[model samples]
Target: MSTAHDRERAWLLVTRREVVSRITDKSFLIGTVLMVAMIVGFIGFTAWQEERTDEATLGATPEAVAMAQAVADAAPQVDDKLEVRLVELDDDAAARAALEADEVDAWLHPVDGDWQLTSESSEQDSLTAATRVVVRQQVLADNAARVGSTVEELEAGSTVGTEFLRGDAERAAVAEAVGFVFVFLFYFAALVFGMQLASSVIEEKQSRIVEIIAAAIPLRHLLAGKVLGNTALALIQLLVYLAVGLVGLTFTPYKSYVPALSGPAAWFLAFFLAGFVALACLWAVAGSLASRTEDLQATSTPLTMLMLVMFFGGLSLDGRGQVIASFVPPVSAVVMPKRILAGGVDWWEPLAALGLLAAFALATVWVGERLYRRALLQTGGRVSLRQAWSAAE
Candidate 1:
């Protein structure tokens, strides 16, 4: 009989082979580079878009320069990043020339004791609104002086202060964004790696390599090696992507979301490992049932559907349903971390959910091992789950 140490060595050799083959594959390396580029490019694009300033130049006759300046100063109150620049015009003809030459976004002058705003085409609503407010304030100040009162006194009781009953609105928005990221990463990694694991298993069988390998090492060891190896690769790739994303985020306005997301991100990785292992086992079983690559789709339909449900559920579920989903295995992998990020969950809730996921992973491994062992050597056609379960070892 093989000693425990020898069995450990045998399985470890298989694990090493799996890891080496994947890392050495040209396609995998190329895909990693492309993904990193996409992430960096996206972050750069977002930063560029955010940093761009909206500028509006207005041509004003000398007399209206002060009004234009007031509009410029007040424009930020309407939209913080808006810049209204004033260009002096000698007369109406100069203003018209400036508008025709695209030297100004609009033209402003006095008409019939009221202000007139003219543009070559449609005017920006924000600029129009800001100019209206400044004009109204100037008129109000004049009226106030006639009545021996101040604009401040007339507007003192009109300002409204905001209050949030639940939490900071900005923080809540950040949490929602973080939760969406978690859901997407989990869904993507699990589906990609799970399918890869299944394909590896079926390919080995198709080439008749598994039979020779199985004779040397226990089938359980083979199964363990494949699952653990792929899990490691999946985790490593995920961490690299997340690291790149976090580093990129530091240069964006959303960098503030980092601290808020850090805790939940860590928990997500932990839950991901357990949940991935469970799904990996099922994927292995799916592969073992297939007699060829052509049958893979037929056997893996259920797993695909499950992943879809998890994806949509993580994004759409809310209220009491969300609370209940945080305890369910697999789905909990995404939901529990989201709830934690959203706040209001007790600390024990994630711990309990992780515990349940771990247990489910263990159970899947046991059942999957039996099915894989029985169906791996069957060559003529695809094997049904019941036939695999009942087959003699």
Candidate 2:
């Protein structure tokens, strides 16, 4: 005699119970704390790396002044306080000897028309390329001055110029970061929580608790409620993690808020939610299909492969070939946002992508619920998608 509304309310109550049970668990609280700690530790590590050391050892010979002057000419921005030591090396061999003896980090030699720069692998990070640039510019400037030619004339000798056809520097950096972060987070969060969904369903089935619940509630309602409960749990965890990460970002020294939230950022946030819901529904269906926790590994393989494809596909954004990928549901949430962050996407791209993403999400959840109702109560064996679909008849 109970109405559909009554059944839905009962189902919601079950979901609420599950959510409450999970949200209050000790492991959940501990995991949240550890996540915060890791964020703080990462921040500290970056600060330490930036502030730790500044060491450079420059070696010279009879050509030391010339070489230094050339470097200075190439890059006039060199710090005046940098120490340029003079070494009276007899030849290239003597310079090599000085480097071998740790007397200098790098040796400079004036070959016939060019300078031979040598440094150990250990000195690579410390040695700035500006040293070589300054030297080259200084040499060119000196020659031009001797010929009574202007610096402008000297510059005209170099015809090559860099061009950016699409976006500016800020946009480019944002796009790169967004693409990498979006793909990584989607892949990571889906795998971690998707497995939890599968395992939870299988556990309930194995314990025979689900069979008892099915007696009072329709099998479809029971399965939908379970998926809804686990999804709520995942969303709660995701929000908490996002809040902590934002706090960490505020404390850290990142300078690009414009790209982080503007143009592509807003669009990305919209699609990411749709993408998460769609993927989560599929994960729920995956959970319902498995008969035991052990079967989850094999059953969830398809979802894992799909996630991997979406993730790796986003990596092609650099080549501007991810345009197609940006329209796909799960992939688009990550890819389109990245393109927007990078300033490569048109304003309408997000709107179009979100529309498709929403349709997919709705369809997936609808189908997932139907499958759950049909397969959840089936005992002693796993239910294939084909079997679950046919059960409606």
Candidate 3:
């Protein structure tokens, strides 16, 4: 019998081999570089879009010049990025010419003691809204002055304030966005790495290399090594992506969201580690049960379906359903973090969820090892789960 120390060394060797081989692989390195580039490029593009300003020019006849200037001055108050420039026109004819020549986005002229605004195509909403606001303010001020009062005095007690009885709306919106990122990361890592692990197992079994390896070390150690090694790689890749994304967020208006997201982000990583181990073990079992690459699809369908359910559940679940899901293993891996970020969960909630996930992960490891051990040396075609379970050890 192998000593405990020997078994530890044995699995470590397999794990080191797995990690080293993947790190040295050109495709993995290239893929990592490409993903990083994409993240940086996306963030850069978003920041550029946010910083870009929209300019609108309005042509105004002499009688409407004051109204046009008022619109220009007030436009920025509504949207800081909006700049409305006034182009003084000699007459209505001149204003029409400016509009035709694209010298101004719109034209303003006085008709029947009211302003008539015309644009070449559909009216710009920003300019239109600004014009409405300016017109309303002018009318209100005139009325207030006629009554021997100020606009502020006339509009006193007219404004309404909002109060949130539960979580903050703005913070919850940010948390939802952050939760989406976490869901995508978890789904992507589980699908990609899980399939890769499954494929690796099937490939080794098909090549009969597992027979030689199984003889020298326990099959349980082999399974443990592969699962842990891939889990490590997945975590490293996730960390890199998250680090790049967080650093990129600093360049955008959403930088303030980072500090609030930090705690939930940490919890996501912890849950992901446990959740992925469980999924990875089942993937290993899926591979061992399959005799060839073509057979992998049939064997892995259940795992795929489970992942899909988790993916959608993470995004769509809310209300009492969300609260219930937050306690379930694997599903809780995504749901609990989202709830924490959205607020209202007790302090012990995540801890309890994580405990359940950890226990589930351990159970999967034990069960997956049993199935993997029985099926690893089977030489014929695909082995059914029942056959693998009943087969002699």
Candidate 4:
């Protein structure tokens, strides 16, 4: 009974209402504020922890100052810049007790003919190695001068200058963390909110709203409007969070506190937006399959399972996913970004992945519209993925 004009107006009204509700909703605003607060609190907590640790270990002692001066006087590399500490224990038992208690970074004692170094189990290897070199050189010079040996005879063997061929350790570590966070965040967000999109569609359909919609307008317009409306809502939420994060980073106190927000951050944000759009359309279609809100799990289980596979597969991207994973929609979001972050993939790789995902998402939206039309009128029993696909045909 409704005219095309009436149906078009109805669709617009529904979509506008959704946009307004999402943007102005009390719960959404509160949730956004809480998320921002949590992020800022985490950053502040980590800095406090690091500062306390540095304060505990980096201080000077009288005996340590004397020993450090002696070592510095012997070796050029042993500069007096380091804050050294000493725990002058009466015996090895006392030293062992102090080490067990973690009261010092290192302890020096006289061995049979040379000095002995003792420290806690968790002492930094690099610091310990540097200390040993300084002390050994000083001992060697004193012994050699007593026996009239040459400087060359007392000098230790040369150390190799190791060069990495494929990757630097710090770079690799940063790349891996960036990749992991991007992939995981993308996957989880898609899976969680994507299902919400699906359920939203199914609820409207079950209530006979789609029938009223279909009587006046084409099925395609109705479906497209719904998907667009939901996608807009999700994007608005993401942008707000990102804006809060950027604002927090601008403060000078948080200079070293922010995540590396340079090249990788930019790329990761781009990929995340593209990936969200690609997945959200398909999820909207999945939501249309259910006749009732309770039927959602039955209809959406396959897509949910696919999302899970993509999530777990992302964890192994650096290890197992080199070639085969770069093109599979959900999994590709994780894998391709990982390769790019690792500096292991070409620039063209992300383009190819995005292209594939876009194509797949469009195809899914088409199929989903057909299913939405068919199932929009059916209710009472469960609607399965097979039934939805067959209805689309």
Highest lDDT: which candidate?
3
Q: Over 4 Å off in model 4, which ranges?
A: 1-13, 45-82, 87-106, 111-158, 162-168, 205-219, 243-270
**Model 4, span 148-241: residue lDDT tens:** 9955675547655666554776566656655666666676567756876777678677777767766677776666666666667766665665
Clashing pairs in 1: none
Q: What is the lDDT of residue 251 in candidate 3?
A: 86
Point to the candidate with the largest TM-score: 3
Model 4 earns a TM-score of: 0.74
Q: How many residue pairs clash in each candidate?
A: 0, 14, 0, 1
TM-score of each: 0.86, 0.82, 0.92, 0.74
Local lDDT at 336 for model 1: 90
Q: Across residues 1-393, which tens digit of lDDT does each residue of candidate 1 receive?
A: 667788778868778887998989998889888988998998899888888778899789988998898888788887776889889899999999999899998988999988999999887776888788888998899999999999999999999987755467877887887788889988888888888888988898899998988877898889988888888888998898888888888999889887767788899899899989999989999999998999999999999999998899999999999999988988998999889988878889999999998998899899999999999999889999999999999
Show the colliding residue pairs in model 4: 198-287
Worst 10 residues of 3 by lDDT: 165-174
- Number of the candidate with higher lDDT, 3 or 4: 3
Residue 134 of model 4 has an lDDT of 78
Best-to-worst ranking by lDDT? 3, 1, 2, 4
Residue 276's C-alpha lDDT in candidate 2?
73
User: What are the root-mean-square deviations of the candidates from the true structure over C-alphas?
Assistant: 3.1, 3.8, 2.4, 5.1
